[model samples]
Target chain A: MSGDLTARSGGLTLPRIGDRALWSFVGRRIGHAVLVLFCVATVSFFLVRISGDPVRQMLPPDATAAQETALRAQLGLDQPLLGQYVSYMTGLLHLDLGQSLFFHRPAFDVIAERLPATVTLAAGALVVVLVVAIPAGVVSALRRGTATDTTVMAAVLVGQSAPAFFVGILLILVFAVNLQMLPASGMGGIENLVLPAVTLGLYSIAMVARLLRSSLVDVLGEDYIRTARAKGLTGWRIVTAHGLRNASLPVVTVVGLEIGNLLGGAILTEQVFAWPGVGRLTVEAVTYRDYPLMQATVMFLATVFVVVNLLVDLSYAALDPRVRLS
Target chain B: MPVLEVNDLHAEFRLDTGTVRAVNGVSFSVEPGQTLAVVGESGSGKTATALSILRLHPTPPCVYTGGEIVAGGRDLLTLPEREMRQVRGNEIAMIFQDPMTSLNPVKTVGAQIVESLRRHRSLPRGEARARAVEALREVGIAHPEARAGQYPHQLSGGMRQRVMIAMALACRPKLLIADEPTTALDVTVQAQIMELMADLQDRFGMAIVLITHDLGVVAQVADKVLVMYAGRPVEAAGADDLFERPRMPYTRALLESMPRPDVPGGAVLDPIRGAPPNLLDLPSGCAFHPRCGFARPECASTVPALEEKAPGHAAACVLTDDDLPGTSEGRRVSGT
Candidate 1:
């Protein structure tokens, strides 16, 4: 113990990635990831089944018994419940999501075709959120209990309470209908991206700004911040370099979850804008009663959420040294 | 002339709930190469007084109502923030009490120290790093370079304190305000840290303002001691005289309350009676009168101004010359 202590005191080094500790962490994450997959599958299976009859939806209105039976057998839908579940799990392990019921294409291909659009839209919105929210949060916190501060906080409150769909409609009414300055909605080009991005990002801006402001308020009162001030670092320097940097963890944590939410819930905005995205594809599947398509889309969204949350957890160790990695 | 002179300083905080008189018309000074220990429990305005020197107190919430904090021949209260920045860390540096939370946990200890050095002096990063290592070594951190890379939580409580001391001394400030620097550590670590501070102070020839509630620490490091009660100075004297003959009742009570190691384990420790008065609803006359066994009728009517009871000892109590009995008499009065 004494020797180990002396060695540790002398110098510290990062542990090897392949070490037991690292492997254990990875193993734990993998276990959690498996559980998440199981949950997604269970929920998706029940949700799609309860939506309507997959068999009737897949078949034509005039199809005969032999034709229906042959189609069911071909799709493995004729299998017993346990057999179907095992087959689905096996397909998942092999990264094979079979053909979409509505699109008449592989589910993987359908999701792949639409994922980039959702990712791009969500990423754009997140960038807008950070660019707008961070400075606003810092400035508001710095100018606490003043007119400017009040104005900023009121804006945040309004943004938080206002729905994204309503904001999207308002943006369209102003930008597209009245001013004719930009496209009302869609993910066609940079010109079309502005309104929807802002609409999707507005609530995030409000949430992140509020979070950051409160975080900065608490952090600025900390002894280290006092020490920084005592060192004669200017107010701007203190806010930007110290206060905001420390306050960003909560913001970062929420950003990941928000991004997942945006990706999943961008259906309304996508519909309003006619953006060719996964959210729109999911909605189309729901309307058509496409069980395979809906299952595949939902499963993908769940995976994104789980992966994002995992990344956020990993970032906790990155942002705060006090969080013991071991 | 004193290196630092605070004359009748009054700092108040207009909290949303109500106004809190943190430092109510208190004053003290520290000469060059001397240690003045401002001893008080939490919320007794000791920390506020230190903050007022740098004008670090946030406005609106913390208002410096009246008085002069003249340090390095300039009134700190009136200095422009830009110039005050130059004075802070360059002339007057502060070490906070909680080492665990004092240093930025995200940044390496070296980065924080070097940041202070870089801000004050136009040193290259390499030179700044060297100075940081030297400062760390001065604070008795073994393998300073290696320790510098490690984060605050990686280090022990004592080590983090050394980092704080290193950071405080990095700029080579004329006065170092150590606000309860060793209060969070274990006894042995506290002794080690105290010794380190004293050793560094001697080497640097910097005056220290040691703000603490520990009388033991006050005895060890202070050249002069300022005892505060309810946001007011109860006693101020040379260290030896204050310890030998604590003039004020509050000081006497505080001294009596400390558990001495020399005393046997079975000896019942005497804690001071009554909690510290709420600053908002402080006692009418002397704040300590409620807790002071030696309170006279006059103590409840008129506030006692801090007056010289002896050549160097000043106490804020109405006790007459003979009322403060001799050491033997004091023991008899306490029935020791």
Candidate 2:
């Protein structure tokens, strides 16, 4: 311990990325993936069952009796509940999610096609969030109790309290309707993406920024900042290199949850903007009661949320050396 | 010439509740290559005095009501922020207690050191990194290269403190304020840290302000000792003189409380009878009167300012100057 405190007090060395640790990390992630899939399947199974009479909703109102009977038989909706559950579970095991009652297409096929669009929109929104949030959080923390800190925190408060949809409309009124700077709503192209992404991402930006600001403020008061300052590190280096990184662990969870939420929506923004995405498809499926299609889409989203949460957990250990996965 | 001079230093903390007079009218000086140990308990204002030198206290909450802190022939109290920033890590560095929390957990120890190097000196990343590794080696870290890549949490409590010291000394500051630097470490580690600090001071010829509550540490590291009580300096003398013949009753009480290594089973851990006086509502006259065994009616009414009891020695006590020093001053023995 005596030698430990004095040794390596000053030193810089290139990091050797651990090959062994990488393999173990991947193995753990695989385990998490399996668990998330199981959880998603279990939840979707119950939800799909609880939703009332898909066959009645699917059949045309003026259909003949024979045609109605044929459609129920084809969907296996005519079977007993236990038999249907067994059939559904069996189909789930084979990864055959069945056909959409309304779309007349394989449920998995439609979901797969729409996944990339949601991924793109969510990623863009995440990028926007990081670009604005991280620096604002860091600066606010470093300049705590000052004018900048007050303004940033107040802005975050307003952003958090105001509904995203309302804020989105407000933004459209300003940037789209009045200024004519950006499109109102849509993921038509890269240019059309700005409004929706910003509208959807703004709330997350506020949450992450505030979370980061408070955490960083607490960290700045820590003895290490004092030690770093004592070492002649300027405010910028201390805030960015030392303060921000340490404060980001808590912010990671908020970011992950927001990513899941944005992926779930932005469909409204997408529909309003004519952006072709999973959220738009999910909304359409829900309206038409396309049983298999809605189930697959909802399950896929649940899976994504679970996976993102797992990733956040892994990052906690990455950001903080004190955290170790058991 | 003295490397640091503090004259009539007064610091007050203006919290939401009330203003706390942390450091009140204290004065001391330290010659180059010497260590001045300011000994006091928590809330005794030793740290406030150290911070006042750099004007590091946050405003509205902490106000240096009055003082002149001259370091290296310049009044530090009035230096501009930019100049003060330059002086802080370059001229006068500090190592705080709780080394575990004092280092940025996210940054690699090496990077933190390099930051100090780059800011104070014009050096590219590679050169700075190289010096950082060399400094780590100098500080006695094993596998300096490997350890440099590790973050603060990667290292143990002791290792972090070493990093702190390395960073503080990276610029070779003229004065090093080690505020309870070893208080958080274990006994064995404390000894090693002290030896390392002494060695570094000898090599660099830097003046040191060793603020600690531990008298044992004072005996080991301090050239001169200033014992503070209720935000005031109660005694100041050469370490040898103060240890040999403590004039102030508080100093005597403090020495008695320390467990001596020489005595088998040690002196009966004679605790000072009462708590330190409240800064907001301090006792009239001598603040030590409440706790002092020798307190009299005269001691309560009249304040005793620090006065020379011998060459290069001063203590704040009216009895020290009395002609009839030993008799009927009614020395209340312990446990009475």
Candidate 3:
């Protein structure tokens, strides 16, 4: 008989999907997601209604009343509010948001067209956040109160304090303008993606680093850390194997929350870089009073937000045993 | 030779507000297969001394000012951290006060044991897992294979501690320092854990440095007992000797406070009069003098050195058996 307690197993073993408990849990979450989406759809529909006449806004000021009337009648805006709501809800049943005023294609189609670029930017930015933030945070926590920790914290502060648009502009000036290493603005190839992704990710990287460092600092003080040390594990091993799992609970929460924000079209960065992503489409849709496109973008973002948060909850249960999915 | 020898150990915490000398000149030794219980109040530095041997204190604030923790023919106090890592869990292992929070919640109990086994042994992954399961079974956890996969929260507190013991003993270190190991458990579970440790000791024959504030625990398993007061060893003797003839005033007070059936019917469970002395600014001489019932002016002025009043028994108080006429001394000390 040995003293080895073999106290815990690391990765989660997924219970069979055929299991009734897991299926019910997923079913309940989907139900909640649907409820949330319905509420969001209802709100965005009405909120869009108040943003002034989409038909009138689309027409030129000098256009005749007959022209305005023709546009309204064609777009079905001449119908009563309740009739409009009923038709809109009916359209939703067929999975149709009306045609984009500007794009002249189905509104969902227009938003979906711009989605890949937005997803690319968001994905690149997320990679940047993880690659830069986690290591810096780990180092800062391990070297706490030393110059290394102080420096990382100070740099994180600068990243957090800097405005996204401002950081974007600075990156453009350095890499695209003066250095002439990449394009200053406008989307083209992977090179153009770099500056914008970095600029967009800067703030989140700082946020994650600061959060991870502090979370880890607290975890390091726990009795388990001493237990790990007494087990004769190296400091680095303990941090990675033991401390990180517990410390990362909050970090996972912050990053999960950040993913939703990033995916919802980084407007300022899109505008600065002229990236032609959904964020830019969102702006054009709003400025041109493209109601269908506007409704589509908001719904899409809301869906992404809801789904991502649900995944985050599931991930929490996966990482921590105490948080049960049921 | 003793399995572990600590000589003139001094450890202090350098907080923002002045230095607090937590363990002051504590000296002791434990023979192989023997148990030396270091009993003390909260601030009495019993925990610090145990932690110091492992160099487990967080370095900046917790500095071992001067000491020698001799083990495996080297002074552990001065060993490089890399070498110290080898000595820890291999030569000497330690279990902490809280079992509930001591094990990582995310990892399964089996994995924690596997980690400890792999740290010192160059076993294959499958072999380490087998060893871990075997260790859990040794600790009396039923269905050890299934229990190894469970998390700490899945087990009872008594079960968690048994897991802790399994992990600490997996490497079979020469000494195990159990710092208040049973304080967080229920009375029945506490007895079970203590008995488990004794049973393990009988099998492996490792020395135990039991740090506790419970006299009851000390009496149960300790072969030799060292009672600490104000961060210093106030009394040291065999458990039987110290229980019968506690030479120091503080040790006398500790035994009196015990609720034993052997005591007279009306004996007062006299609590020590004052709180333990502040380690930051310990009083002029003998740290416990302020609270001693028979404090002479000399007890306040001159710090008393621990000296043997009888063979194999020593205490640090100024008075001898001669100072108190009727106090030989258990009968009068127990009156509340």
Candidate 4:
């Protein structure tokens, strides 16, 4: 026991993550993400087919029976359901999301064209949420029980409880209709991105802020915080240096979940703002019964969400040293 | 002149239901290089008094009703907050009871020490870090460089306490307030930590205010002992004097209650009667009167002042020295 004690305390250095161990951890997480994506593709491919016959929706109501049969055969929709699923999976291996019926182009190409817009909106909203929420949270926590804290918290509650479509409409009414300071819809300059991003990001902002406030409040009560104060650290230093990092653990989890929500599709926000993103594109595909495009979009979202959650886990390990990656 | 003087300090916690008076009119002084142990049971206001000196208690709930904490020729209560920041770690440092929770879990122990150094000293990062390693070495932690890079969870309880001591003493403050510094460690480790504190006090020549509930800890290193009961000091005297010639009934009861191995095999230990009084609704007159075996009619009607029973010893009780039992007289005691 004494020898064990000496060994444990003998060389007290920062915990080192070996290159091999780190790679193994990353590899394992990546493998799990891939498995999740595959499952998503399988489920979505089978589920979309069950909705109805796509050939009937693809053609007009007055089209001839021969025309309908020819269309189904050409698109390979006439095959058995099991055969079609296997073929879809096989095509996915080659990264070919079969052609879009509406655009008469590969589904992947069509979706990729609009991917940049969704990415931009999601990234912009993320930036807005982080910039606004962190300071608000820290201040609310510091001035807890005061009028300032109550007002900020009330604002956050409104932001969280309000539906995305309602918030989008409100922003459009105030910024576009009343002031005419910005465009109401479409992808253009930074101004056009503002309303949609804020509408989609408001709930995320509220979530991050609430989580950060509660976490910081708990951290402030810790003995280490008192130690920091006793060490003559100013209030700002104590909050930023000693308090924020510890509080960030829970906030990071909330932020990661919000990112998944944004990337998967801010469907309602896109509709209200008329933003040209994958969310709007997915709605269009579902309306026309574009099975391949819908499947590809759902698969793409599932992959992004899985990868993002994996990164969140890695960050958790980084933020808290005691949490080791297995 | 005394290094730290606390005069008639009163601290209370205001809740929705009522106000709980934790420390009532407590007063004492510690000269340079002396160790004054404030001994009491749980919730007896010893810890409250220590936090009061540093003004670390939360304000709305924890209010200092009345008092003055004078140190380094200035009244701490009157000092502006900005200047008070300078005095906190520069002139008066503190180490808490549990070393486990007293450190930032996410930060390196070295970073914490360097934080204190750079906060008060204006030293660059590199210099502060070097000094941090040196501070760790001063506390007898082996592999100081390696230890400095580690987090608090990586170190043992004893080592963590040493780290706390190092952090407290890094600025060479004129006074150090240690609140139950060894309460969380094993007996053997406790002895080592206490010895380390004594050694550090000798080298730094900083007065220490040690707050503890354990009489054994007080006897080991305290030059002066202040016994508190129900949020007020009931007795104050030199360690040897208080141990051998306890005058207050409560103090005598406390001494008698301590389990001794050297007593004859069949001797039954006499535990003190009654629990400590509730601070929210304390009994009338003396707080300890209801528990005192020697309580008289007057003891319940009026509180007794802390009168000097010896040249330096004082106790707050209605009983005269001649009226108390003689069992504790002429007995020599030393803490293990």
Which candidate should be chosen as best, given TM-score against the real structure? 3
Clashes of each: 1, 12, 21, 0
Q: Model 4 clash pairs?
A: none
| Between candidates 2 and 4, the DockQ winner | 4
lDDT of 1 by residue, B1-336 (tens): 787999999999998678888887788989889999998777788988888888888897888999999987889889888999998888899988889898877777887888888899979877887898888888889888788777787899999999998988888888999888888899889989899988898899999999999887788788999988878888899987787788887887777777665555414567888898888788889988888888888888898899999898898988866897664123211111
Model 2, position A81, has a per-residue lDDT of 68
- Residue-level error in angstroms, candidate 3, position B63: 1.4
lDDT of 2 by residue, B120-210 (tens): 9878888888888788877778888787777777787777788888888888888999989999998889888998899999999999999
| Reproduced native contacts, each prediction | 0.50, 0.48, 0.70, 0.50
Q: Where is model 1 more than 4 Å wrong at Cα?
A: A1-20, A54-83, B260-268, B328-336
**How do the predictions measure up, each by TM-score?**
0.92, 0.90, 0.96, 0.95
lDDT of 2 by residue, A85-202 (tens): 6777688789887788887888998888877777888888889889988888877886888999999888877876776668778888998899998887655678777877776677
Candidate 4 ranges beyond 4 A from true positions: A1-18, B265-268, B329-332
Query: Which residue pairs collide in model 1, if any?
Result: A185-A273
Instruction: Please give, for residues A1-326, the per-residue lDDT of candidate 4 as tens digits.
Output: 11121223212222346756667888998888878888999899989988777899878899999999999999898999889989989999899888888789999999899889898999989998999899889989999989999999889889989999888988889899999988999989999899999988888888899889999999999999999989889998999888998999889887997898997668888888788888999999899888988898898788778888988887787778677667
Give the range where candidate 4 chain B is weakest over 10 consecutive residues by summed lDDT.
B327-336
Residue B236, candidate 2: alpha-carbon lDDT:
96
What tier of docking accuracy does candidate 2 attain? Answer: acceptable
Cα lDDT tens digits for candidate 3, B1-336: 999999999999999888888888888999999999999889999998899999999988998989798988899999999999998898999999899899998888899888999999978878989998899999999989888888888899999999999999999999999999999999889989999999999999999999998887887898999888878888889988887788888888777666665556535576889888777889988998888888999987898888898899988988978884443344422211
- Best candidate (score: DockQ): 3
